[model samples]
Target: VGSASIRPPATAGRRVPQGNSCNFGQGSRACVRLRGHALFRMAVRNAAPAVLGNALTCHVVAGCDVAAHAASGDTAGGQARGQAWKGLILRGWLRGGLPCGGQRCGSMRAGSCQGSRADVPMHGLLNARGQRRRVLVPPPLLLPLLLLTLLLPTAPPRCAAATSPTTRPEPSPQQAAAARGCSAEALLPLYARIDDDLRHWAAHGISEQLMDKALATQTTASGEKAIGVLFESGVPYVVSPLEEIDRLGHHTGLITAHLRFFEALRETFGPSIPDVEFIVGTADQPAIRLDRLENGALPYPLLRFCKSETHADVLVPDIHFQMRAFNATLLQQLDVINSVAWGEKAEELFGRFSQYKRIIHEHIPTLEVHGAGGENICHHANFELLFCDVREHFMKWAHGVRSSGAPVDVARQPRIKMIDHARYKYLLHLDGQTCSSRLEQLLVMNSVVFKEESGYHAFYHHLLKPGEHYVPVWKEGPEDVLEALKWARAHDDEARAMARRAQRFTQNYLHPDALACYWFTLLGRLAQLQRFEPGRGRRAYPVVLMASEYLGSNAGKAYVQKHGLSRMELPRAKRVEQRRA
Candidate 1:
């Protein structure tokens, strides 16, 4: 059948690889060398000048068309053809004469024949007519030739899938940023916007209009003086970002979030702003003017501080810093609670959710009091009092679930478990009296963060879109939580996108460098606003006094005495005249 029945074409010898495994044939008879495999039944084309002009010049046999493999129900024939094809492709690699479009198939090794095996009708090899003719794909050459056909870059195929006519390629920078999602190209723009906003605020004092958006109406005068003196002083202060929680000696868990931010801030911008100080404002009304304290007293002692978060006069740390949890992927699934538990009830609540499904879990109470409280005064005092406890709501939900035979515990679920569960499940983060700092961290995770609407705003709150960035849940009850979870499961892709968007947003706006730059930029603007007196408040002040108690009475007393412009006095206790309105 080789030469007797079929005439040999000019390119036939060149097309067939130097292998005894394959033979020129049209029947299902096994080629002797390929006794274990079936041969491709190819139809030999007549040796005539190719009719297809300017295409690669080569002879092709039309037997069982390779395309037939796709539609053919003959599994045996398909297997034979595939094995034969692999053998031929291997031969092309052994022999150098095969025109793999002049390109070497380095990736296609004998051990690794796995690649795009789509039978590509490739026109290559230039004949004497200077016209291209179809080259019969050799066994080894089949792989490389197919590869060259793809890699040789040409115009889009006429029969290719249609694309929207409105589509235009993104700019290189944006394309690169989109590819990486959170690279500097994407983040730097957000950082620039942050820097610009802070500069605007620093150039001008906190605006009356901006202050009107306060969640709180009143502020402590002593708190106001402490911040004012710190802001006015041309010195850097090293203050604990946890002073707000430490003052009440409660809400211990809240400190870890802010501490993460301060530590990151020190790591990122510490070198740039060596004199930077961290500060937090009145928990109730950071934006309000603190003219009177609870005791109706104006602030004194003039302890120096630069604002850290909440206040615009001083630099503010964004959510990225606060919510940055430990590397989520490396974290283990087993919840770890190494710290001391407040009490037995707290222990039970804060204990690990051993069999918790990868669903939304929020151990923090919907009411007040974030972490559990201990029976002892020291343990009880460690938790911040927001004056609103959601123990009843949590109990109802927990009891209902447990009664239904599924014991649900949202009370404890440690951070490690939270992050681990987040990878494969939806996470529900309920806000207590104020917003949860863990919200940012949770949102950054791969899981969908179902958030209940609240009055609190992090630095990045303005950037969060309801459906686009997070799944919104009502503060009403567990039903809404269930509904939100249902929606997330139904629209899984959208939920995942929201998670990615949330992550990208945090990486951009809350990046350590971005926050650090915001810090310095705010100071630079504040420096312009300062009323510089000759030899007065213009040395690089880098000392920060951080205390939850009266600054003059605590470690800040010495700092105030040494750095205080006026003889510092322990701020007088608020006159008992008018209070508790």
Candidate 2:
């Protein structure tokens, strides 16, 4: 009887149509409507095993007698049975029997698994009662294409988690200390007590736009801020111009040295800080240089000003042309702006204090000075001021020396290039814009350094005492240069001792580690003085320093290169000379 239900009996109305060979039901209009549905189900049932595997093939092969049941007019019973059959098919599909779970997954239309394995032909077949019945299936293949499709994701992946605030990782220990809010908190003690006061300083230089774009990102221990810029290559950071203030005529070497200091610090510390955005101001000198007030108001809270004088939040070393000694070989090769050699420590370049006199003895007279050039006892005044230009104060002093018929040589005119220091026993040191890096270099040379007293000083300056490390000359006039020259000639042994003392100070205090300590200390103090608006805050410098440590010095270089930042050029005596003129 079951077989008969599957293969219905042929009767007067059930006779096969002219081209069709299906027995849908006994003589009835409903039977005509069913048409080729029985044939379609039978063909599919028989052929599907080869395409859909046994798991799915069995469902079609053993389908219920829907045609007979529906034709009997047992509406309630037939509908229940139809639902049961549908459930069976659905279960089979969902159980990984069809590619991408077929229509059973509810993501696609029934029986139309688009892009399914083998594109098995499918159609909705009806029974004798005109109710939808079985779906047609095709022959299976050797490949488990359906299974493969089932394994694939139903929809595209999303990036929502990455952007979610909750998903963001809490900052590390160092980061917590450098967080924007923490930076604001740290500054609370030293800066504006009220919101208006903080804003006042920000408006003066550090605008919120500037903070959001640069200063407020993250913090590092070394206190280096990376400006957003692109390399001739590429890096992954906010790209912006390197210089914040567009003013020209500032010292670019100062900028480069600051960058290298950060790079070296980051290379040293591992995770004590992180990288952050930074913008370099184009100020010609520190905002508050010495006792001279360049600005009557407070500077940007985010700025780490190279302390011009006392009462500064942070103290930064003067541009250490000392960095140049390391690039002795490469300096001549790079472009003008990129030529200020740095990244090497002072101790590394010239050895220890003990070896100073010997090295100076060997390297002195590196080249011969024309016009009455002689040994340490030359006819020309041992004093030679190889300056591109002379300040009025220095000029007046030089004029006085000439008027007094002093033996010292005054190369004060513009275009007077740096000459060899060997032939002369007395070397004259001067300050143009601020303290010169040449001060450090001259102190190391075995020659007697005749320094003019000025308000400007450096990290190693305080350690230098008159008559102990150098011969102090008068800044008001040129008589001091002559007076110092006379003293040096009169007391050769004592003058040499002063030069030795200067060399010792550099050796003991200017090592990279020592300088790094100074850098770290200055940043720490500066962080303590920073203040912020009620909610607005920049990152603590520590975090910025740590990030550099994480990314490493090489990464820093990559960033600079990617942004196509040129090296900061050391101010040439010639340029200053031109400016003075």
Alpha-carbon TM-score of each model against the true structure: 0.39, 0.41
Clashes of each: 36, 37
- Tens digits of per-residue lDDT for model 1 on 178-249? 322323454444444345334434434433233222211221222231221132222223232224433432
Which stretches of model 2 miss by more than 4 angstroms?
1-257, 274-282, 289-313, 319-405, 412-419, 528-581
lDDT of each: 0.34, 0.35
Model 1: residues with Cα > 4 Å off, grouped in runs:
1-185, 188-235, 238-279, 282-315, 318-386, 390-395, 401-409, 413-416, 475-478, 528-581
Indicate the residue-level lDDT of 406 in model 2. Answer: 59
